[model samples]
Target: MLEFDIWELYRMMLRSRLFENAVMKLWEEGKITGEMHLGTGEEAIVAGVVSQLIDGDAIAVTHRGTPQFIMRGIDPVLLLLEFFGHPKGLCKGQGGHMHLFSKEHLIAASGIVGSSGPAATGFALALSYKKQNNIAVAFFGEGAINQGMMLESMNLASVWNLPVLFVCCDNNWAVTTTTNKSIGGTLIDRAKGFGIEGCSVNGTDVEAVWELANEALSKIRNNGGPQFIHATCTHLEGHLLGDLLLRHNRDPVLMAETADSLKQYAGESLNEVLMLLRKIGGQTKKKGDPIVFIKKKLKDDADRLKLIEEEVTKQIDQVVNNALEISKGGMKND
Candidate 1:
């Protein structure tokens, strides 16, 4: 497995959570005018999967991909500006949250369905042609898996012996519908038909996803071919943020308990933030929030971790304020 610093993993996950929380606040305040989707409970999958990828690697992410962008080392200030439709965003405010691209980082995300799969195949083909010891990863939800192009791309990757990793972030729901109702057979099993190795894991468990992804990356790099990681994760909110009507399997009680757990994390005058988290958490039914889950894992050093979170929260707040000021002032990044 890829050896990684556990604390760094925790730090990145915490940062992703704080950033999402910031976006939620901005969206509620009518600053990020559009559909908002926060991957609060699903942060681990992105953290785990992306941590295993390095500089030369290429990645294509789906609509619920801001966390993936954060894990890829994109600056949150720029991303915030982009989310706010400011010219300073990663795509200069044109792409918003769904499309974050950085050629230097070899990363791209699309708001469209099943698009990343083919995009990844093309990247893998390039990497192979250049004889580079790099892999391309495509991340999509279970709903996208049903798309014909998605499966076709997997086949293309396998037939070409391309170094590609397909990560199906299966939260079991396609918007308001469950995956079992929409999909047939198993994701891992179906990959065998395409002559690619596949496995499923607990998406909330970041370490597990990292370990599996590391193994797949190693095999792809050393042996040359495609592989799959089917991650079964949880979504704490609707497919779209503030979409109560599309509520699928959320549990108000669990969310309330999650809210209670945040009291100690709240600082003076940050009660609004705490209240926001609590309100969102009350609607969630996931077994554990990614940030809270990792905090529990680091319980032995909870004091230090908590301090780190406080520091991160401060940084996020500062960056967000700066981004908003720049956006509101009509300052151009160009």
Candidate 2:
């Protein structure tokens, strides 16, 4: 059995959450621009898998990759600076949040759907050439599984017996559309079609995901070929920071305003919008928060947990302030 420190896992999740929360605040304050896609609900999954990664193990993440990058040990200051559009960011502020790349950490992210598959597959191929026993991880949403490139990557990994773990953070929504509405069948079944064996778990349960990921990584390290993990989670902030469908559902005034506009122009799509809102509302109600779930388990050690939270919050606050300070003067290109 794989033993893990639940407190540490909780800390990782908490740190990622707090960092993103700070980013969200920056975006809300107009300090950051563009649509911000956060990995708020997939914290457990990212922390669980990343905790087991060793040096040389590469990771390719989907659009909501802040948590993954942070867990993989990327500097939060540079990441924040990147979001702040600083020249000394991970990609010199060119990649933004979605297109972050940390070559030193072997981590890459993209906003395009299904891109992680190819990216990770390429990483796995490189590792295979080195025969380093290192592995590559592809973190993406369930919706990406339907893409042809993703399926091809799975097939190639299985065929080559590459050390890659395809982690599907299934939040049941592809943008505003639910999984069932868009996806044809189960995500596991799709992986199976590529001859990749896998399992599913609750993403909100940090310990559960950690245990499962540990087993999967062990198998890959043992030359058991590629594996897949389908973890169901919730996107607490919807697809984007200020997502209209989710906002409309939560705010009556916004709903009224959206409904009126839709009724005036796109009356036929109004019911469809409301139906999606209902689904989103239902998803939020049913899903559990990863942070809350783990915190409940550690409530007996409230003092320690409180200390960790405070420390992490302080660290993130310092990172933000430092990044902001640097952005004021700007860092020259190397």
Candidate 3:
């Protein structure tokens, strides 16, 4: 039996989506600088995995890590302040969103593609040395599997019997190129070659991810050594916020500009680009929206759902407002 609270998972997913939406607004208004990578699409995978984590457990995530950090109980206000480069931010205005580090939470993230594997493995090594019954998790994209460091980390984790769960959030696209075109063979087979047990799951379903992650964590806790989870998710917002391809699909002017650029330099036709964009856009449909999927399942308790959404919205609004005030020097910092 799947023993978990659907409402709690729904609330977590909703809060992550709303929080990222607020961050998107900030980036749009030019308040938050730099290329922001919103985890707008991978909410289910993040919530499912992070919610199952206990204290003393560690995590290392990829560049699109806001969802995981927030779900892991980091203060959203501090995260926003960091994005704004405020001195009171998480890394004291130094790390921004990509290079977030929270020793208190035992979580660290890097913009580097495959660095999470090594970081999480190191955390697992430390846990082993200290004789703690906790584990470490590394979250990365399918593209990172090709990186030598990532493969080596997996091998090392297996060799030394480290309690680390390597999660491959395969979105089928590595930035712009299709991941299947680059990655050879199945990821599960790759893990098996390294003596690690694993499973694959549809990351869009929160309950599915939750159940599988719970089972994997249970095994790791029982000294099952290193485990792997190849969860396939959709990167609905392309690679980053204000993605050029998605922008072209939305704005006619950008579309024309892209067409002209392609014709002038690459000699590619606009028809080809449109066809590709259409295919990508089709994937971001009703079936892929994890938030709506879970919300539908919880429809029996509509009143409770409404209250949860309202609470999350109000909380996120206050967080954004306070973070903005602090960023604008209108409020005191902690």
lDDT of each: 0.82, 0.89, 0.89
Order the candidates by TM-score, highest first.
Answer: 2, 3, 1
Best by TM-score: 2
Error of 3 at 161 (Å): 0.6
lDDT of 2 by residue, 1-334 (tens): 1359887888889999999999999999999999899999899999999999989999999889999988888999999989877788889989999899988999999999999999999999999998898999999998898899999999999999999999999998888667777888777888888889999999999889999999999999999999999999999988999987777778889878777777766665667777787877765553468888888889998899989999999999999999888888855765
- Residue 223, candidate 3: Cα error in Å is 0.6
Q: Tell how far residue 74 is off in model 2, in angstroms.
A: 0.8
| TM-scores for the candidates | 0.87, 0.95, 0.94
lDDT of 3 at 268: 55
Model 1 is weakest, by summed lDDT over 10 consecutive residues, at 244-253
**Candidate 3 C-alpha lDDT tens digits along 1-334:** 1357778888889999999999998899998999999887789999888998889999999999999999999999999999988889999888999999999999999999999999999999999999999999999999899999999999999999999999999888888778757988999999999999999999989899998999999999999999999998887777899887777776678777777777755535556677667767765666878887888888898999999999999999999988877777743455
Off by over 4 Å in 3: 1-3, 260-272, 330-334
What local lDDT does model 2 show for residue 117?
96
